[model samples]
Each structure stands twice: as C-alpha cells, then as structure tokens.
Target: MKKKLGFLALLLVITMLVVSACGSKDEGKSKDSKNASGDEQIELEFWTMQLQPTFTDYINGIIKDFEGENPNIKIKWLDVPAADLSKKILSAVTTNTAPDVVNLNPTFASQLAELDALVNMDEAVSDEDKALYVKGAWEANNINGTTFAIPWYLSTSVTLNNKAIFEEAGLDPEKPATTYEEAAEYAKIIKEKTGKYGYFPSMDLSLVLQHMVMMGADLTNEDGTKAAFNSPEGLYAFEYFTKLYQDGLIPREALTGDQRSTIDMYQAGQVAFFDGSQFIVQVKENAPDLYANTIPSQAITGKSGKKTMSVQNVVVPKQTKHQEAAVKFALFLTNGKNQLEFSKLTPILPSNVEALADPYFTEAGDDAEPTDLVRIVSASQLDSAELLVPPMKNYDELRQAMYDAISASMLGEMTPQEALDQAEQEWNDILAK
Candidate 1:
C-alpha cells in the first residue's frame, strides 16, 4: 500500500513538470511574433522644405523608386514650408511623432546634434559612399565626430547683377564688383548717375549675418559657446553693410521691405545688383524679359578675401526605428544623378561633385554662362564653407536686439560703434541668463 502511494506522488510531480514546459514554449513563440511584426514592415515619415515647383515631381519620383526597390518599406512625405519647418519640427519632436527624416538648415542640424536628438550614422553609411559629395558638404553634417545628416540640396551665395542697370549707369556690364568696397562704389555710382539706388541691400538680419561670416569673422567661436560678432572682423563687416545705407546708396525701400520688395526693385530696374543664392534662376524664370540681362555669380570678398554661404541639410532623428533605411534613402536621394536633375528645377546648386560636371551646367539657358564666377565661388566653398551660427536658446531675443541696434544705427539714430557696443552688451546679458 505504501509503495503504490509513493508511485502516485511521483506521477503527479512528472505531469506538473510537463505542463510547465509546454507553457514556456508558448510564451517564447508569442514574444517572437511581436519582434517579427516589428522587423517585417516599417512605415517611415519624411519632411521636405519647400523647393521649386518642378522639384515636387523629382522628389516624388525618387520616393516611387525607393518604394519599388523596397516593397516592405512605405514612405509618407510631408511638405513643410521653409519658414515654418523649424517650428513644426520642434512641435513634432515634443509630441513624440516627429518625422523619421527631416530637412533642416545646416545651422539647425548643428543645434539638433547638440541636443543629442540626431542619430550617429557611422554604422549606417560607409566612407566610400560619402566620398561622392563635394568635400565640405559631407563634413558639414558631422558634429563631435559623428555624422548625423546628409547634404540633399545645395545653393551657394552668388551675386546677381542687372546688366541693364550697369549699362544705364555707364558702368561695364561685362564686369561687376568682386569686392564689397567695389560693390559699394558701384552702388554710389548707380545712385548718382541713374537716380536709382545702385543696390538696395535688404535689411534681412540673416543676410547681414551671412555676409559678416563671409568676411572671415567668427560668427560663433570654435566651441560654439560664444558670440564673436564684436570682433574686429565682425565690426568691419557691420560697418561696410551699414555704410551702404548710411551713405544713402541703398534705398529706404530695401531697408524697410522684405525679399519680395527687394526683388521688385531689381525687376523695376531700380537696383544694379542683387546678392543672394542661385535661386536667382527661379526669379529669372518667373520674369524672363525683365531679368533678361541678369548675371549670377559669386559673392564679393572682404578685406581678407574669404567667402562663405549658408546651407541646408537632411538629418536622421535618433528616435527613428528605420534608421538604416532612412540613411540609405538620404544617400540615394542625394546621389549625383538625382541632385543634378533636381537642381535643374530649383535655383539650388548640386552638392554632388559629379553632378555639376554636366554640360547643362555650362548652358542652363540663353543667359550668359557664368563659368568663371561659378568656378571661383565653388572653389572657394570647397575650402571654406561654414555653417551659420546655430539658433541658441535665446536666439530670437538675441537676433531682435542685434537687428534693432543695427537698424537704428543705419537710420542715423546711432553710430555703428555705438550700436555694436549696445548690441554686444545686450547679447552678453542674454548669455548670462
């Protein structure tokens, strides 16, 4: 009777063990199903800053091509207005639904990198693949030794001269100013002879900042921790820009109005020169006859002969689940062929080294070929392209202070030094906060 009882106990223990093993297997399978679902299909969201109208189809074509090659991957694109992209991106990031891929100003990319929100794309991209772009463009995406973004589109600072104004002012239309001092001289000449301001240098603080940076001034220090706009170079740049207005060379219309009005003055043959990006192509396309005499090329030099321009970039966010795919798509979209095709539709230049080699670059339209100017500016950028100072925590306030000071000084309310002194103090106070 005792032996039979013991045998029953052993049987019960073995049966319980078997049941536990079956449960473990079932649990493991459930967990794997969750992981498999995650791996099989990935939905990606992307944002693009506004480009030329034709660029819409070009970007969509790339999306279609990517979808064809990657059946399991799906992309949803959002076209963000250029003016609102930074604001929207910040809002989305706070909401935890940010786009997997974002197009941003290079300055903003640097800010995102500082925030630890950008992915370190070292494992996602290869050195060989990176070699395809112009030298500094790829470098621009790197912060603290980690590459977080890629260069998708590029435009360089080029001077757009109104040949008609040049001729009307009795200046050589074939040759324009190659230095700021020269441009100013030309402005004065145009104003005197034509009774139209030679150049209405727009009072966009951003443009003022860019040209200051071009003049070999450290807009921000090396550590990215301080403003150097009070340096000698910075003051020199500030003085020159203000002189255009102070000497009554630039019209009040330009100092008070925005880009639209600035261009309107040019179209009306009221200005001799327009300094800006290659997007002058779009402006020319929109009013061909009025701009028939337009000539586009490099920005003029400073006392030191240095040159610079702002750039926008595409960055992969840290929270993206499809990081590898996102990086791959960025590279493919920025490939030489695609950039060349896209630039044709936009005023931006191709950052791809190979893309600019196309014959069309030499003959964009019936307009005068800018081979000499393009070569000079492109060459300068290869060695000296620098991103503008990233927007800081108090960037808005700081910019406002600077703008008010500069504008006040330009309006003869204060001298340049006095304005800069006040600006420096105000900026330093903000830094303290």
Candidate 2:
C-alpha cells in the first residue's frame, strides 16, 4: 500500500508568491515577539496534516526538547485536518499568513514547489544534512533536481500471501515470489491447482505509472516535454496485464475494478495474495480465517529491480520570517532520534539513514510477529527504494490516462500497443498545456 496521508480535496490547487518581510499587526505579532530580557523570541508556526490527539504527546515532546535547546525560538503548532490542507494552504499563501513549517506529501509539496510557494531545500540544507537521509527518500519531492522539502517518513508495500492457498497450489509457503515474473508463474500454478486467482497487480489504478517505471519504462522524454512510455518497455507492461486477463491468471474483475476489488477478493479468500501490509489488518478484523493463513512478504519487483517508496515531507513556506529558526526546527523534528521515536509509534520507516540503521528496524527478534518480519523486509528494500513515479505535473491526469488505456486493452477494447499510443498522446497533450 502507498503511504497513507490524509488529504480530502476542498480545492485541488496550491500557489502564490512570498509574503511581505515582517509579520503584519493583523497577522499577529505572536508569531514573532521579544522576550522580557529583550532577546528576540521567534515563534514559528508549524502545520501538520491530521496529526492530532494520537501524536499530541510525541509532537509536544519534540517541541519541548527543541525549545529547550533553542530558547529563543518557540514552535506554534497547528494540526489541520487533511481534507482542508489543500484549500487552506492555498488560501494561507495567497493571504500571506502561511505557517513557518508545513508537513505535506509529495503530491502537494510538488504542486507548491512548482509555484515557488515553498522553500528551496537544496539551497537551504547543506550536503552533510542531505546525506543523513536515504537517497531515494530525500529525493522523493525533488522536482527537476530541485528539492522543496525535507524527507520525514516513508512507506513501502508488503505483499501478503495466503498460506493455505499456496500449499493447496503445491507452492512452498516459505518461498514466495520476489519478482513479478515469479509471481506470474505462481499465478498459473494457483489457477491450475487451486482454482483461485493469483495476485492483484492493479491494486491502485494510479500505480500503473509506478508499474510501468518498475518494468524499466520511462514516462517522459529527457526534458519531460513529451511522453516516452509508448516504447518497448511500456508495451511489455501493458501486455503483462492483457496476458493475465486473457489467461485467467488474475481475477476477471481486476480488469474493471481497482484496489477495493482486490481487497474484496482477498477477504473472500478468492485470491492468493494481496500487495500491501496494511491489508492484513483488515483481513484480521474482517476475515479471521484468511488472516490466520496470512504470510507477509516483501513487495514484488518488476524488470527494473527497484523498490517503490512513498514519503511524507516537511516544507518551509517561502514567506516565513523565521527562516533559519523554522528550518532548524524542521531539521530537529526530522532528525534521526526523533524519526526513530516516530517509527516506533507507527509502522512507517524513517527517512533518516541513521534511524533506519537502528536495530529496531533490522532485528525483529526470534519470536517476532509476521508483521515484524514484514517491517524487516520492507526496511531492507529502502536501499533500493525510490519514488518510482517521481513527481510530475498533472500526475493524476497522467495516471488516469494510463489506467484507462491499459484497462481498455485488458478488456480487448484495443491492442496493447494501441493502448500505449493513446495514453502517450494523452499525456503529451496534457503536458503541452
């Protein structure tokens, strides 16, 4: 599963110029004030999406420790409901009252960076600081070689197999497929032996872009001015889906449905494998028998031999008066120590290289839960993990274009190459605007 970030669209947009130099009186001097000793006391406002009562204690602790270290700077924390972030941020920037530091996902961060509303992190952070994070994690929100945010936490999928299904198919439960080719083989065996579908490749319709790239296909030209996924690699990715549908390897419903359909099939015990770790939680609650038969494993790679990651990031607004302090607190908030603590509270992996190297991520102990092994496997992938789709303009439209075209081919509405041609033209058309 992709990293879950709470975002509901009020207005699907973000952009604006930097606000004026100092905080205006109407904007509240509380954001910037002087202490009783006449020392400059800078209050930096921080905004995060949907991190409330659950993380209150942890965030408060970070703020307290940071304030203790940098007495002159105090953080004014605000938690915005995920659904309102887009509209509120767009409004905030337009109104010149944006927060000093904001937590965002790659999608929103990319949009803001495109408008120059966020800080240029590459210019603000030193190479030493950048080196502290995973190469892929840190670059998740880097658009056109310019970074606009600091990496916070990352999420990678863990493919969950049904042990009973595997054993019924005469496949060893202990040795699951590590790549899509092996997975297709397992699918054939499962369908032949057990009469159940193999796996759900199109868990997320948007993931078509990711899958194409994973299969060693480029989505765009050298300068990203034209679509390039109509090449041989792209044709192969399309043909993979079409072949599965035609051969009855995956569920026929997968051609018409998305992630929800995959979940439904898995919960009904009609599919052998699911493509994410979080799905097991639902299975445990909804389908106890399937949950009992669950075996968590690492995600399946495609031809590229790379793992995919989703990141949550932190960005400073270009208009913040406390640039240095805001940046320092952002850095402090995402440091290895703090990241390790957050990772414990959540199943997510740390972006920090040192934090990821902690024993907690590497060793789940002898009596570890199936999930513990899942985390360990996922952590191992971080070395190869990257934001495979990378941030692109009109990404939703691009994903939709690819999804629609590919799905049409899978349904025999068109040939695979024709599907790629249509998708490529649609993408180039969107990019042209």
Candidate 3:
C-alpha cells in the first residue's frame, strides 16, 4: 500500500449523528428475498457514509465477493452523507423500510442501542470473533456490556505542527506539547514571540464534552442515567478554556468555531499547530508551503495521557428480516482481511487487532513522508486511545446544553462553578426525559 491513500477522518464532522431505529421486519416472500418457509434469494440493503466516487469500485468489489460466496444473497449499497444519515434512518424506520446494515461512528451508536433499534452483538457474535478487533475500538461500540456494532476503521489525532512557526517562536519542532498545559504554554510563547496564534481550540457543542472527557471528567453515573461531570475535573476543563479565551491567547472565534475553522487557520498560516491530522492532505493541496513544513506529533492529552479514538463501525438493525445473514455480511465486511485492505486505500486504521499488528502500521521508516510519520504516530496513539466521552442517551441534547453553559461562563455570563451547576441540572433534566 502507498504511504497516503485518501483522507476521510475530515469527512466525519458531525460527532453525534443518529443512525438508530430499525424498521419493522418483513415476512412476506418476494422475488428478491426468501419464500414463506424462509429459504430463498435474499436482497440485503446496506448503507455507508460518503465513499461513493473515491471507493466505488472498492465497495462494489466487496459486494461482488460476498455475493459470489453466498450466491443466493444480493447486496444493495447506498452511500449517505454524514449529516443526513440519521434523518434518513429515522424516516426509514417509520415507513417500515430500513437497511440491514449501516456505517456509523461511536458518538450515536448508543442512541440506537437506547432505542432498542440495533442488534445485540454480544448475542449475535461469538467470543472468538470479538477478539479479532482492537479491544478499545471493539468496545467503543458496546453499550453497557452489550455490543451493537462491528468496528471497521479507526483514527487517532496527530498534532500537525508548522515547522516554520516553531522555528520562529524558538520552540523545538521535534518536541511538541504533550499535555494540555504544555499546549497552552506553547500557544502563549508562539503568540508572544511570533505574533501568530499558538493554537486553535474549537469550543463547539460536541467538542465541549469531548474536551471535558479528555480532562478526566466522567460525564455520567455508572448506568449513564444522570450527570456526574460537575466534579473537580470538569470544572478544571471549563476554567482552562475560559482563561485562554479571556487572556486572548486562542482565537476569538474559538467560542463559535469548529474543526473546519481550525483547518482553515492552519492552511492560512494563522495558527502554529492543529491537533488533528485529517486535513494534512488539504494542507498539501491548498497550502503546499505549510504542508512542506508540516511535522506530526502525538496529540496533546489531559490528565489521562490518552489520545481520543475515532471509530467507524457497522451495525445490523435489530429487526431486519434476514438477521443471521445481515450479521454474517457485517462480520465479513469488517473482518481483519477486509479492514486491512480498506485501510491500505485510506489514511484510517483497521480496528482488527491482527490487521493492526501488520508491519505497515508498526513501522514508518526514517525516509518516510511526513504523512507516513503521521500514520506512525497515530498508530502508536491508538495504543492509549479511547472514546473518552462514553455513550449515553440523548447525547446530542446533553452536550449542547453543557456547551451552552460552558460558553456562557467563558463569555462572562456566569462563574465557572455556576456554569457547571447549570449544566449539571440541564443534563439531569435531559436524562430524566
């Protein structure tokens, strides 16, 4: 496989998308499916998130192989946009028409599990099969102790630093910040010495909770029934950002921006380091100058010293008529071989533990491209990665409320403690619903 295949972690912008709610099962026999007695031709509907033009042949070939092996079954694949997938799924369930399988991230997989809309992987898949994937990646799709999805590809952030800016700021490019505190210090020095922003932190809705989790804040109780993040760790997260915004260290738009803004800042040479690797390809294409000076390092952590993991998984809807077949195809699609093959064509990592152990991931040589180094760093980061913000019901609503409260404190509307109190109250109310 080449050093760079394609970049997609960038395409997963909406962190909490809803891919829940399976439709009513169909029992009637059709030409495309089985007979009333239940053994006949079956046509399974499958959905994916935005892989059409670039990986059309790749997916089509997967379907071909699966169909060839199971000659009685056919696959119908549809690629969905990240933003629209949830809405379409909810609509599909209402009309009693839903896909057998879907591609989703950890953010909202729990929502489906809450709705009792997804197949329980703990019962559907065997123990031997479960051991095939990276423990963290595989468990990310788990709700409570029950698994709901098959882990596909995974990604961990690699801090993208501009060498020129570091040099100008008199900071060592070889040693980027390892902790959030160090990152803040680096930002201050970068801004003071180079007159360029040190870093861009997006305090957006989804990210507010994510950052808090990274800071060792547990957002909910053991059963995830209520808010538990109003603790010391959570308060520290708010204070950290609030101080940064007040001191004029981070970008003013940090209050309202998202990762896209962060990417724009890096490409425009407005920020020194971007704690994400998804947009490096963009830097190469739109800002080759910056790309030429791009250096990759492990992402900054909080108290946990762990990087955040981004996992893409596939789930079988709970009530699909062809439950067994749906589960089998999903398993096959995300098996070590298939995942490894897919990772070879993209910048993502395979969740398959065996696939992850391949030399390609473990080694990026001295003469490797910066992008390859990015992979090497990211691969290592996975060893200590996790979905810090565990799955919960009404996740979007809870995060939005918390984000609003945090923003209010940062903008001088309330004290940090007051904001935490308000956020905690709001979270409890949402959980109560």
CA RMSD per model (angstroms) = 14.4, 3.6, 6.6
Answer with 1 or 2, whichever has the higher lDDT. Answer: 2
**Cα lDDT for residue 8, candidate 2:** 25
Model 1 deviation from the true structure expressed as Cα RMSD, one decimal place:
14.4
Q: lDDT tens digits, residues 188-306, model 2?
A: 98999988988878636558888888889988998888999888899999999899888889887776676788888888888888676756557777888777778888788888987
TM-score of each: 0.81, 0.91, 0.90
What digit string (tens of lDDT, one per residue) describes model 1 on residues 276-356?
444354556666865566776566767655555446678887656667878877877888888888766645667777887
Our tally of clashes for model 1 stands at 0
Candidate 2 local lDDT, residue 348: 84
The candidate that wins on lDDT is 2
In TM-score terms, candidate 1 sits at: 0.81
How would the candidate models be sorted by lDDT, starting from the highest? Answer: 2, 3, 1
Which residue segments of model 3 deviate by more than 4 Å? 1-39
Of models 1 and 3, which has the larger lDDT? 3
